[model samples]
Target: MTLSLTELAACFEGVIPSILCTVGADGTPNISYLSHVTRLDDEHVGLSDQFFSKTARNIRENPRAALLVVNPHDGAQYRLDLQYCETVGSGPVFERMAADLRATSAQVGMTDVMRLRGVAIHRVLGLRAVRSPLAAAPPEAWRGSALPRMAAVVDAFADRTELGEIVDAALDALEAAFRHGATMILLHDPARDCFVTLGSRGYGRTGIGADVLPGEGLIGLSGKEGRAIRVSDASRLRRFGAAVEASSEQENRTRSVALPSLPGAMSQIALPMATQGRIRGVLFLESPKRLAFSAEDEAALALIARQLAAAIALSEADAAEAAPDAPIPRRPSEVASPHIRVVHHAHDDSVFIEHDYLIKGVPGRILIHMLEAFLSAGQVDFSNREIRTDRALRLPGLKDNLETRLLLLRRRLEDKNAPIRLLRLSRGRIRLHVAGYPIVISDRKSGAQ
Candidate 1:
């Protein structure tokens, strides 16, 4: 079969190191190792500039170079004849390379040493397979055109009525349309300036309510920079300060404190969701095999994220209504079982339950607010409008994510096995089931209440 550099896109995902052979002015050869290489297009590739002083000098004197890249999945190798194009010191290419290098550095514990100076773009003159006895495995099956699937996914969003249902529909469409193995959706927390996982699938740990600050990890970096972040070889980069705190009920609860990725994940792509010029959240997709996503996947998912963001924005207030009248049990009938001490630190919006940290940021503040309401009014059912209009929330954005924060707080409480429980009564109404745990609320500055 005829060979093309673009056909070997999997080999250029920067999962495995590549070799660069350059000719010096005197005809001597210099070889350098490349930590990262990305396919710029069908005819070009971008190589990360690291400690390649000699290779750079050789390339300058003689613009001819040979690149040897290997497919990490199948051990397939190819040699490409390259003609030096030019160096890109800034722009999108440089920024993506820098972000990826930071992930690589952290994987090898070289965050302080590795620095990206520029990206050396190269035009592929030709490509040929290296002779070997081991036969290369067949290439992965392509998902074909995403247009038809994208249409279906978008249509699914149009059919959903409730906000939570829309979130579920978005995830279902992603998995069904793209064939992505693991998928998750995170909501941006404006008050805390962080992203929290609200829903996820295809993970051992759902990581719901897990918080990611800007630049913390891949998901965090994506939300922080308001751009897409794609990484193959996710195993190494997965734990770079990325952990999901599992509920204490799980046997491996200790491991959950960190952010989580799909188990045995080799590739991941994070796309930021934006609506009306503001980033709302991020959509993360992962696969167990390497190079699971391509440029098409990235572009398609970005478009999907944009559409979903608008849907989410429109649905955020779908829950704003008066509390529904139902046969709600009286608080006095439900006798308290245990006393759970709760602390709210206003300084950082942190919450601790029974001396164990439960949640922080806006969600934490919301939890405290709920406890205060329960204590004062013996109220069990609360509506979205009530929470949104509450003077205590001080929600700091054009869009109030009261419902989303409630989703997060509920998940955190469930994971921690806290006595307090949040039960959804209807679209905009939630009933707090505080059985066996009487909450004692106290401010960070003042004494107990």
Candidate 2:
């Protein structure tokens, strides 16, 4: 029986390297292992062209080539007869392949060594299954249609009006409805050119405020390319949890938060939450079982991610339309407490509450601004409109991401057990609650008692 590319989805996952065989003009055959084989369409596949000079030369001489791929689940093998089509230097396909290559290289600590030159497209002429002597693995049991569960998740997002609640609902749905226990949501910070961990579930630590650069890892690559990337067996890659632990040990000196991760995750997928041609964030999920997420699962997650992105965009729009509320007069504190030292480092806009790093970047700036207002005018209430338009804050224009930044600030304070808290009073309005008097210090030189 003939096998279609869609039926052999497991072989293209890059779990096991695919072998490419080509014949040179002198009739000399050369074989190379491919890092990735992206299925562009039903008739073509794109091979990652990085350090494949011999293969490229062979393709120039002869368009015919053979590829061998294996199904990671059942150890089933297939041979595909291919014809050289074209090499793409730049486009959506190349970018996706490049991002996937970069992520794979980072897994083995060879990110700098492996540089993608282009993606060589090949038309699949014919496909045939190779018989194996070993007994095949049993077929996986069906998990039922995910649409019903996914609909519930989407409905949950609709019910949330606040950015924080929407984020929480998405992560909660991943575990409660989809049975994906380990999940995280990282929002993109355009100013820093990185993604920040805003929400997470099923980790020992929340890792809120952690930063991940574009193309650094799976989560970063997904957001960088604005597409979904999945790994079937991650045991071959370096454990990211160890790196997080190592970074966590130096948290005091670096003031960097650790990224949450599963200790022995075998399968992982990072789905980009994109809307309006801009990537807002990434929804990352991991499981201990190999191939935990099927193609259907990825499609479902991608749909949910899109809905999440749209919901966040709508929430931001709603907040933007809300009129600034009149400031309320400050009331006397119910209890008297000792003063808490609040330090703001001007160099990076990082904030420290009594020597413990609370947050940095835009969120840090926002916190300092609110604290200054509280100290100078005894003002506790502020509006998103004020922060968005505050030239001093210098938030990104058009799509400032004010709501998420505020959420990060609020969560960071709660995580650090600080005396300061940010409470949402209404749409676009928030109140800063300080249990103890705050001693504001700026740039390590100036102080106000």
Against the true structure, candidate 2 reaches a TM-score of 0.87
Each candidate's root-mean-square deviation in Å? 4.0, 3.2
The TM-score values for the models, in the order shown, are: 0.84, 0.87
Per residue, candidate 2 scores C-alpha lDDT tens digits across 211-233 of 88887788877887788988888
Highest lDDT among the candidates is held by which one? 2
Off by over 4 Å in 1: 1-4, 71-76, 99-113, 148-156, 172-180, 235-238, 242-257, 320-346, 353-356, 444-449
Error of 2 at 314 (Å): 1.9
Where is model 2 more than 4 Å wrong at Cα? Answer: 21-31, 49-65, 82-96, 109-112, 118-125, 239-242, 246-249, 323-325, 333-335, 386-398, 444-449
lDDT of model number 1:
0.77
Candidate 2 lDDT score at position 177: 78
lDDT of 1 by residue, 1-449 (tens): 99776678778777888999999999999889887888877898898876457888998899999999998767888999999999988998898788778766644557678788899999999889898797878766667877787788889887776667888888888788877798989988887778888888777776776667866666776887788878877666635543433455431333124456666777878889998998999998888877887777788788889998888877775665445545344454344657777776676677777777777777777777777767777778777777777777887664767778887888778877888889878778788877665565555648542
